[model samples]
Target: MYTREETIRRMNGLGRAGAPFFFVISHDLEHNLLFERKDGGQGRSAAFSLPLGERGGLRDCPPLPEQIRFDPVPCPLSRYAAAFSSVRAHLLRGDSYLLNLCVATPVKTNLTLPHLFRFARAPYRMLLGPDASVSGVHGRACACFSPEPFVRVRGREIATFPMKGTADAATPEARRWLEEDEKENRESATIVDLMRNDLSMVASRVRVKRYRYISPVETRGGTILQCSSEICGALPENWPSRLGEIMMALLPAGSVTGAPKEATCRAIAEAEDMERGFYTGIFGFFNGRDLDSAVAIRFMEEDGANLVYKSGGGITVMSRMEEEYREAIAKVYVPFDL
Candidate 1:
């Protein structure tokens, strides 16, 4: 693992840019080491792409309000099947419990691809610019974001949203509907419990301020429903110094991974066929007093000359393979709104 100092130095080397670049924090199972990389200077070469264009919706589209065009390159299913069986065996042996198994789907689209337009239109949505890229590895596309704390410094306050569940959101009340959904509830609880433990590690006191809160994001794939639980705690005066450690303690965000973190991570190593690269790492910027970062999801990496978007959902013992398969496919998008 790159030392906290090393990670910060890399960021500083990028100079002042539009935003802090993408970062990937990955632990190699075989090597048992952590890796960090700044996005390097690849942002200048990066050509953004989105599915939505001048064309309003695709012609002859479904009536579903959340429906959108999704196209991905064909990938071999045999590979994913083998990996799933391996993970299932581990679960059966009790080596690991819940794991988020994933695979990459190389994609191509005939529809309009949004690049310069995204920055021109929605500036906040643009994560990285000229210096935007993963932190540890060079010349790689990765997704990373801040944890989005709801508290500010100089006070005795803290809040974190432990995002956990996902569902289809094609309805007008997508957020409200998902808030009461059972499947989402169970998943959010597991991660909320995990986050509470995480906060307790470095917090003076912790509390579950809210439970089963919902957020909806419109993507090219459709309206993805996400459920999160808010937890708060009291931090020490020296909390800023240990912020890196606190974030590291929550490595491989529980929401993206699964419950019983360690074992589940092991299962991911055994079950996941392709290298995750920077898919689930966290990245953000801190100006000393406060820090912000994001769990690297909604990410795309290049496989040779082709771009492959990586996405998947957490799996429990209750997870169905068919449903999981659909979720994996549903994640590929160019960040287009339906």
Candidate 2:
């Protein structure tokens, strides 16, 4: 684990030298891994890459395996309800306007970590740790198949795409509902405002380029419509040399953490009663001149004797416990190109 200061210095130096690198910063900003592109030794740090379309030079991944099955047992409705109540109380008390609460659901699967990654289809994917070398079916590994970009920079332009709303796409009016729902619109707008503020700290001329837009995401359970917004800003001169500092300013991804960040994060910890570890974290690559990264959502970590899928959504004063609980459970599916 590198100290935040040390991580910043090292990233700045690498950025100045124009060296290609990849980094994963945990949600709490306590643990981080940074590796040079040429480093072949996997020490707690394995393969981390942006979605194929975003990576300029990385080779495309091989085809997925024939078939795989994943079975997940979500957190009890009562438990999620309790967490939701806590967040709602906080909202009522003016402690936070919005909070992103999450839970880990224990999953049973017939495939190992590598096989799971090979079969999973996502816009952004990452595999961390030494699980691939182990012959047994059981091991400690964390895989992130995410769709939201935490931030991306090319030249002097930086952009963040914050995803906030979700609905079952199979429903007849899913896309229309997601786009027109007052609650969902409020949720996405809040995060977009937070992200715009975050960017303004290290950037100039921050603006919301796009408002709430609906996109279809494919998952094993079926298609789900997600609402997202694009916010972009102009980085100050010599921005690349301050890459670490800039990232530090926007971390834990506003989309996942919530508005009024510090207080909301505290409430999240107190209500959830578990460390998020790397889930909801940030991972991406800086290929010499450009950077592309994603929020570590749609994540699964291998715990002893079980795999845990971590997922959640935003909570507000208008949020319903049952609706939030259902959203959490619905996010547990893995995407495959069936």
Candidate 3:
């Protein structure tokens, strides 16, 4: 658990030496830890699973035990409505165009962090160490198996895949509907614009290379189709040496936070009223040359003797309370095969 200043310094030093390492930062810009590569990407506090190839492949993970199990308690609609109302008020007052609202729902799962680390079918996954109290990691046992990538850098080219707006893939013409729906389009467009602006802060010739691309997410509950876009920018030739400054400028990721990032974060605090911990933070690996990272969504943590999964959706002036509540709840399933 290093301070931001220390984390930046450590990251920059690694960059200068071209050392491969792993890093994680929380939503509040508070807790950040950078672990230099030790024994082929084994940090003292965590084991990593990342997709480094064209396909979502990863290092060897343990085989699953039989009887995969997962069941999440539904969050009361009333609680979600209250939070939605709070955020919507901010929107109505012109505080922000979009604000992402998240919630913690206790899930009944006969699975452990190790089990998830082994079997959860996600490209970017992590299992926090020896125990939760291990400092930089969450204070409770936790693991994140996130489908959304925050950023990727190769040579002088850096790109972000901003995921927003989800539709039930089970529905007829869902992909077409997600692309055509005004609200969903607006949400995805806002995030794409925000990410483009963020990248321009440290790069040149930023542009949206892809818009409203569809990616299907499979869960134990069902299939969810998500909309995302690719925004790319040209970084300096020495970008690796200044990786810390670049990362600090581009995160906690516009897709998770929202447009007008600063104010929206404050609005999120007032509405969420609880620490996000690492749920929406960014974590990544720098493989000495190229880098890749994932937004810390699709997250779960151990709470005392129980397991809690954190999930949420973006809210806009055009958002509906009932629909948004259902979206948040629908995001709660573990990434498991039937």
TM-score of each: 0.71, 0.92, 0.93
Q: What Cα-based lDDT does every candidate model obtain?
A: 0.53, 0.81, 0.82
- Give the per-residue lDDT digits (tens) of candidate 1, residues 128-190: 322333222444443321222322223445566666666678867667656775665667777
Task: List per-candidate RMSD values in Å.
Answer: 8.0, 3.5, 2.7
Estimate, for each residue in 1-338, the C-alpha lDDT of model 3 and write its tens digit.
77677777788888988998888888876787666665443444476677652221234545565776677797788888888999999999999999999999998877877777667889898767544434334576668888988899988899999999888889989999998999998998889889989999999999999988898989776888998899998999888888888898888788888978999998999988457887899888998899999999888888778988888899999999998888888888776775
Candidate 1: Cα lDDT at 205: 78
List the candidate 2 regions with Cα displacement exceeding 4 Å: 51-67, 131-140
With a 3 Å backbone cut-off (N, CA, C), the pairs that clash in candidate 3 are none
Global fold similarity of model 1 (TM-score) = 0.71
Which 10-residue window in model 2 sums to the lowest lDDT?
A: 52-61
Candidate 1 has its poorest 10 consecutive residues by lDDT at 48-57
lDDT score at residue 223, model 1, on the 0-100 scale:
64
Off by over 4 Å in 1: 1-24, 27-70, 74-77, 109-139, 143-156, 171-183
Name the regions of candidate 3 deviating beyond 4 angstroms: 39-45, 53-65, 132-138
Error of 3 at 23 (Å): 0.4
